[model samples]
Target chain A: MIEALQFEFMRNAVFAGLLASILCGIIGSFVVVNRLIFLAGGIAHAAYGGIGIAFFFGIPYIYGTIGVSLAAAFIMTAVTIKAKNRQDTFIGVLWAVGMAMGVILIDLTPGYHVDLMSYLFGSILAVPSADIRWMAGLGAVTLVLTILFYRDILAISYDAEFARLRGVPVNLLYFIYIALVAVSIVFIIRVVGLILVIALMTIPPYIAEKYVRSLMMMMVLSVLLSVVFNMTGLWVSYHMDLTSGATIIMVAATGFFISLGVDQVISFSRKRKTQRSSRKMLKTKKDAL
Target chain B: MTQVSPVIQVQDVSFSYNREPTLTNLTFEVPEREFLAIIGPNGGGKSTLIKLILGLLEPNHGRILVKGRSPRKMSKIFGYVPQDVNVNIQFPIAVMDVILMGRLRHRGHFGINKQDRQRVMELMTMTGIPGLENRKIRDLSAGQRERVFIARALAADPDILILDEPTASVDTAGKTELYALLKDLNETKTIIVVSHDLMIVSSYVKSVACVNQGIHYHPKNEITETMLQMGYHCPVELIAHGQPHRILKTHGDF
Candidate 1:
């Protein structure tokens, strides 16, 4: 892997993966804790429409995709806020529509001959230095914004009503947060593709949530886990000639299951020990009687 | 005596959802430092009234004033404990962190100050759960969770503390203790609670306002027959407590 990094594209790929990991770690923690997995999934899928819009219009991919996805995010947020029960139906519709529109637009594009597989299943190895720089810039902005508004975000995420009472601009922050999620999803699509974006966004954070005691700690631990998974997946995929995106997701999923099993085992043993001690105390009382 | 303005005033307020009226022609006033409990049957606009007061919702045809200002303007002066915190219990957050969120209003660009931390700790100590500050919120029992929420609300040090169904999840002993705590807090802060527990309301509240489609403000802790018949499910005469056999046969059996 060290020797592989000597190549420019390989270095760019590594950089891309690291940047994607940072984003997934931070935004994904919020998605998991806020239970916005469905919303994030909807945004990820809907972003495909933006990709299609870019290709169809012969415009810059990031600009088109980010705009469309943000619009879709705002619409979905509004719908979810208005009719929470019906949000699933609307989100599902938007997801399918966005993907369908992307496919149709790509099909109609004049003389378009790009590998659709890359957009659908990720092409991290093909990442250019320019895209890597873009990812880094976006990552920096996300980190700065998160730090600047940590208190308000924490208050809102923990309890919106209480946050509102505290004079936190809950709705405005919500819109901005979702827009950031949309942008993050767009970049993450370059690494894991739209279909697998949700997995990458949720798995590491879900695993970290059990061990960490605060949102910031969860994000830090999640970032480390994501980086490890991404690096390992890249190396393993290179050796096995497998898909890098799916391999990374599978690594994270494996971690998730392992954590769940370990958690259950610890809780089960703790329960049994307590039960045994209580029963022993009852027997001692009986003996005394 | 100085003529201080009322802490809250609702003037002919009517709210509707989807063009259907939820609350109509509601008018009320909460004076300073009063313990007022709003009680009614489910879907009787009690929650809506609270929402209106919190500025979470607007009245379609009337106005609501908190401290002689609009609800939104006076939002910071009100500390609220929602009926449902609606938190993802599995989320990674400590009890101390949750309580300190109440001090977000006091946060500067530098983040929470030592005074904010001390206030949170003071509230925790007052609520009798100082030992549980470091624990995760998910680990707390229902009663403990309520106390944490109450402590969080008090951490804001607002002039009015509004609680929605504060005792809903509490056990009987916990409910008594919670009311006692509220009674103590009422000495300095105006207390407004929306509760379904009539027994608790009768015991602790200085005033009772029954909200249904309209508003009925009882200046004293008195549940009149007329008020019960107007909005509640059961008539006051039929609710004979402590007898296991005296259940209402129908919605309006009496």
Candidate 2:
């Protein structure tokens, strides 16, 4: 693992993983806490439409994907706000339509032979320096904005109505937050691809949520957890020649299961201890008699 | 003769959802330092009136003025305590963090200010939930959670404090204690509570507004038979502990 960092591609992979972790740690915390996992999944899959649009129009991938992804995100946000009862159905439709559109657009592109598997399974080892720079820039912007509006975001995530009554501009902030989520989803697609992007955004935060008592702590811990999973998955997949994106998701899933098991064990032991104490007290009462 | 404007004035405000009118031509006024209760049956537009006052929804026909301005623009002056926190119980947040979020105005960039922290602690002390500041919000009991939310609402120091069904989940004793707290808070902050809890409305509130599709403001605690019949389809009968049973008339038919 130490020697692997010498290669430029490996260095880029590690750097890209770090950038992805930062974005996931910060934005993912908001996503998981606010229960926006499905919305995010919709955005990630819909981002495929952006990629397809880029290839079809012979433009850069970032431009087309970001543009279309943001548009889709705005549409989803509007639907979620206006017709909340039917948002799930609409998001499901958008998710499928985005994927179908991406496939159809790619097929329609002339003289283009793009490796669809790479986009689906991710090619972290093949990440270019330019993309890494883009990831860094996006991550920085997200971090600054998140910190600047941390209180408002926290208020909105917990209870949007209360946030509005407190002068938090809930609607405007919600639009901006969803837009940022869309942008982050696009950059993360380069690291883990679109299919596994939701996992990367949610798994670590879900785990961190169990242990931490504040959003900030949860985000920081989630970042560390994400880094660990990304590095370990990258290393394991590198040695075994497995798909990096799938491996990272598997690692996160294993961690999630382990945490759940550990939580159960802790609670079960505590309950047993209480029961034992009560039984001992009963025995002592009988002994006194 | 010039006079101080009421803290909240809803002048013939009408609202609808999906073109189905919920509140029609409702008019009310909440004066300064007053503890008022807005009570009605389910779907009687009680919650809608509160939402309109908070500017979460706009009135279609008439206007609502909070401190002589629009309700939406008066957010800083209105502290709101929703019926339920409506937060996921498993959300990882401390009691203090929940209270500090109320101080989310234009303070500093990163952390809460010293004055804000002091104010939060003061509110915690006042609400009698000081020691539980570090506890997880989910760990607190229902009553304790209500107190924490009250402390959070008061942390903003708003002139008007609005609560929606505050005692919905609280026990009888907790409800009494909460009423006492609100009665004390009314000394400084104007309180507007939306509830269906008739018992408390009879006990604590200085004024009552019976809202169905419209509002009938009663400037005193007495619940008149006419007000009850107008607000609810049937007049509520008080038949407990040897209390006189007032025969209810439904839609003008016995």
- Chain B alone: TM-score in each candidate? 0.88, 0.87
Candidate 1 segments whose C-alpha is farther than 4 A from its true place: B1-4, B107-110, B232-254
* lDDT value for model 1: 0.85
Q: After superposition, how far is residue A72 of candidate 1 from its true place, in Å?
A: 1.4
The lDDT per prediction is 0.85, 0.84
| Pairs with steric clashes in candidate 1 | none
TM-score per prediction, in order, is: 0.93, 0.93
* Per-residue lDDT of model 2, residues B1-254, tens digit only: 23445898889999999788999998778878878887777788888888888899888989999888998888778778878764578899999889987787733234578888888889988877878878999998877888888888888777888898887778888778778888888888899998766566667788777788877787776555667778654233344553233222245442
Candidate 2, A94: how far from true, in Å? 1.9
- Report the C-alpha lDDT of model 1 over B181-228, residue by residue, as the tens digit: 889888999999988775655668887887889877877776655566
| Candidate 2 residue B38 C-alpha distance from true site, Å | 1.3
Instruction: Give the Cα-based TM-score of candidate 1 against the true structure.
Output: 0.93
